[model samples]
Target: MSVDLETVRRVAHLARIKVGDDEAVRLQDELNAILGFVEQLNEVDVDGVAPMTAAVDASLRRRVDEVTDGGNPERVLANAPAADDGFFVVPKVVE
Candidate 1:
């Protein structure tokens, strides 16, 4: 795909970017180079490669799921700006 000055101008207009004719020519060259690099990257062979989130081999640490009250309600609500009846109070929104 060839990126021309007209395409650059149209892209700039769609993106709401302010670019003069000289800037558009420069942007055209840059966009063309980027597309060429992407074309080269698309030619790589990865038939059996597995998708990975990170380059390092690390596993996420997980614990067994258990359901219980956090055991310290007063400590958790200590920093609340407004608390009432063991609950954080908020302004009533409905009439």
Candidate 2:
């Protein structure tokens, strides 16, 4: 559960980050400290604690799911350089 210098180097390479020997050593110490703290947190008892997404309770407002156009096709295609059959027409790319 502890991070070593080689592990730090591997992680840096995987993350595409360039780290020198000194920086690698420093990151190694920091990662080890973080893992140590997480290990300490695992020692706590949470037998009856409920999982929550946030501290406050709230619900999202929703609208009916229905499909309808903007009620005007000519207006929608008014600014298009080329439109046909109530749709924007683009240059064909393939034969």
Candidate 3:
């Protein structure tokens, strides 16, 4: 999984990034180091380990599903350039 200068140059070209010869060489080394770290991580044993979204388990806070008026319809429509019958009035595009 080692990255070469030519591969780094190609990656830069595909990413639409400007990388000079020296910068490309540096990027090649950096990419190789990152790949090496990922390879090291692949050696770890995780058999039967459950995937987790957070470090600690906790129920997500939620509100009961209920219908309620948001209130302040006039305030919500105040910023509209044109509003009719509590709705935004836009130019008719279809005949």
Candidate number achieving the greatest TM-score relative to the actual structure: 2
Superposition TM-score, candidate 1 onto the true structure: 0.45
lDDT of each: 0.88, 0.90, 0.87
TM-scores for the candidates: 0.45, 0.47, 0.45
C-alpha root-mean-square deviation, each candidate: 10.0, 9.8, 8.8
Better of 2 and 3 by TM-score: 2
Give, for candidate 3, the lowest lDDT window spanning 10 residues: 64-73
Clashes of 2: 0
* lDDT for 14 (candidate 1): 96
- CA shift of 70, model 1, Å: 28
Model 3 residue runs over 4 Å out of place are: 45-95
lDDT of 2 by residue, 1-95 (tens): 99889999999999999999999999998999889888987788988998788777878768788866688999999999999999999999789
Tens-digit per-residue lDDT, 1-95, candidate 3: 79778888888999999999888888888898889988987787889987788887888889889967688889899999999889988999899
User: Clash pairs of candidate 1?
Assistant: none
Q: What is candidate 1's lDDT per residue for 1-95, written digit by digit as tens?
A: 87878889899999999999788988999999889878886678978988788888888888779865687889989999999879999999889
